[model samples]
Target: MEVAQVLHMNGGMGESSYASNSLLQRKVLMLTKPIMEVAVTALFSTGATNFPASLAIADLGCSTGPNTLFAVSEIISIMIDLCKATKQEPPEFQVFLNDLPGNDFNTIFSSFLPGFQEKLRGQIKRKDGAWATLPCFFNGVPGSFYGRLFPRESLHLIHSSYSLHWLSQVPRGLEGNKGNIFMARSSPAEVLRAYYEQFQRDFLTFLECRGQELVVGGRMVLTLVGRRSDDPSSKECCYIWELLANALNEMVSEGLIEEEKLDSFNIPMYNPSPKEVQTEVQKQGSFSVDCLELSEVNWSVVDTEFNPNVASKDGGYSMAKSVRAVAEPLLVDHFGEEILDEVFKRYKAQIADGMSKEKAAFVNVNVVILLKKIA
Candidate 1:
């Protein structure tokens, strides 16, 4: 893989969206409540399958932040609830947080250690009357999710989020010399094909790993972007890739840049559809879908013209701005930080202020799917 692509995720910089997403767990939990109800019910009802006095749990792609331990916490909360209902022993959880090798293990371990210790003490008090215990022995396994990251049937429940859409590579066949149909233009057949192809490959691998890690009756949740192709537009946070595209087009119209460069730029993100996602999950053949729902939580209502304008106020930063926030940084890594940060700052300001003046768009897509390990 190219260095630009490798650095695209901002390895070790502690500045990726994952680091800043404090609301990710709450938002995810909110969107997942319905599915959780189903999964938890199935687990509890299956003859009250009692876990170890301590349960083993894992969070995949546990990015370097507070959100990684959520799977463990959530499981603890639910298991406690189940204990009350069934009057059976609650499982003491042995939590493992996993991520890529380059992940911020120090930060993750530090943040969770203090709280983890306390939780362990609490567990002892609850179960044995007095306290003085090593909380749920928390540890880190830093590695990619593409292959086995745990012992067979080692985890009772597994959780992953938002990280899966990233394909290992920009889809091939989009390049002209590669002889696929995608040319330097928007909506090219080959462009989308390559994108979906990568998605399919990676998504299936995710399900396969999930299939492997989960115990026979265990369940998992997946949340990702599911878009409506006809809409062809999205605006989330202060970052609006498509709207910025329109601004760039405006700059081009005013002779600021050549039109030839348009196709060279893309959103650098992929939003798959619910149908497409279902197709991939079904293809994996190891999990059965228990719930499928979509929420436009990241979406905001914007001026109607934002869709058709394609060359004026797209309600976000201009392509010129994005060149700084994204392209510039990718080209000159060390020098591009200030430039990208400045560009994003301005873009953010524009969204906040312009939205006050106009309706602004909402670009949230929270897809919550609960899958049972049928394999």
Candidate 2:
């Protein structure tokens, strides 16, 4: 299935909605604030001499949430500060928020826009006698970032967070990938090869597409899930799936779901190493990789509000909610909605047990990269 047809962060502000359950993504964005500021500042520093009258910025894979607007605001704020520091007038801003077509854009537009526009309007207000205007406009562009989603050389700064690890679709030949819904330590060599190849194809295409859309010297800042180890089966990256598979297997034993269903499922995601990302960037040859840095967070540290209620056996439920917010829609499509609660109930128990043994946590590594389109 085309991911654009099925994949989206859960919509709206409901309990399981992406809007309410996206604290982890928010943390990832906050952690990268310095990098974002630095990249935007550097873009204007060298390119200000020929700066366009209007700045075009797109946040590709920008799933709807507070984080999306937070990113847009941060980028615009940095640009404004840089302009003031350089004694140049701030350019009118054209901001594009890109995501899959299935994303909850109505919630984003209805709830997020009024505040965002209000902020922009305030930025245009001047203290001095003379009136000045810095117009900033927001538009939603729905599509997969793996292919062309913008016009040629139309963007000046592009940003994405917590999104690129997702492949365009699940890799083929997963029938051989017995007992797992995602790549795991036990996955066959062929299954591994299929995933690696898909990521290679998807990511390079992403670079090539953006390369065409971004002006020469345009900057891009991307933060995605990644692994620190060279090993593809590293615990840091694959453990979550391992635990998830365990829950599925338990359900199978209880005859709650067909065993074949479990065997046939595979997740369309990859946690690439820094070397892997660098190789693709070098191979594509459209952008110069400026910085590749890794930052790690424990699942337990992601959201204080969602922390486990140890007294109530809620140890791993927060992590489960975070994962479900992203994965439930896909799982529901495959296994049917009737099994959703029960499946995660088993999953929460499994996660709690794993946490009890030795603090089970995600790799939660962010591969932060800054690239500049080569002229």
Candidate 3:
């Protein structure tokens, strides 16, 4: 937990990413499939823990929403089926739904179905009551995982998505960017080196946390964006986010925004390669990759679909909607909401103008590395 010091929450890292998260559907799909296998394999793994009784689970960085529960729901669904097939008692369950403080835990917890109570009751009625009376409850632990958030060897399974790349802190030597260091990409080797070093550190801490928290042979599945290739110049493959960030910075020079605010508003994307992922896990000493999935999904121009509230006029991806989703609150944080409308107007055309069906075929980077804590 060396990252506990700098990687701890400084500000805004936990803010709402859902507003423009429409692009997450494809990544989520890719992430969910392999993990279904992991859940099933865990049930049958020779080293597997007893059914249901040993199934305490946690979704790290599970931002407050039903959306974050996609893997949670699917895994539980598979586990339930396994229980029925084995004719064995369901395992005791404890689900820790965690996130940063700025997350919406209240919204998430309040939405749990009453059937969950029935689910517990059903597991309890098992001939073996240990499966039922197990501590199958939900907890909202809000803070950086860089600090030891859970007790040692407590979790049986863990899942995280699109979250790991965020460095616990902006990299060192980014003093020029101040607290806004990770908001976008950089050209200098030091910037990229610092970013990678921070990830290695934060990732090492994450593995250390998992090492202490997971059971012998306990499992985990982590999915996040990554670079498609090692060649840095591949337009289709490398650094699409940097292009977007530059677009954002251009808007700053147009007198459309403030320099300080723009610089502080980082994109926080990570593009670790598959090899890098494998290396990071192996360095942790107790985990091994089960599967690493890279997924690519497409979008259509005629789709014209956008969430109603924040959507733009007529149709298409609303720069106002997209930018303001991050920028509005951001600018308002530094300046004031007084000019939110103006700022949106200033940059609306810039974002839309860049969206071409042939050129920028919008896509997401989903890297799912399934791991087993083999002690």
Instruction: Give Cα-based local distance difference scores for all models.
Output: 0.57, 0.84, 0.58
Model 1 lDDT, residue 11, Cα: 28
Candidate 3: stretches off by over 4 Å: 1-31, 52-54, 112-135, 175-186, 231-251, 260-265, 299-348, 357-361
TM-score-wise, the better of 2 and 3 is 2
lDDT string for model 1 (14-102, tens) is 43334342342345556666666666667767743455566677777666555566556656666666766667666566777776665
**Native-referenced Cα lDDT, model 1:** 0.57
Q: For model 2, how does the per-residue alpha-carbon lDDT over 22-104 read when each residue is reduced to its tens digit?
A: 77788888888998988888778787326888889999888877777989888887877777766777788899989999998
lDDT of 3 by residue, 1-375 (tens): 123222222122233234234334434644477566665566455545544345778888776343555666667656666666667555556788776666656656665434455654575466345454534566788888666778877777888876776557546654454323242333455555666777788888888888888877778888776657663223433333444445446656686556776655543335677777888888788887777778754333213332444343423244334334433433455456675555555344444554543335345556778888787
Report RMSD for candidate 2.
2.2
Q: Best candidate per lDDT, number? A: 2
Candidate 1's clash total is 12
Whichever of 1 and 2 has more TM-score, that candidate is 2
Model 1: worst 10 consecutive residues (lDDT sum): 176-185
Ranking by lDDT: 2, 3, 1
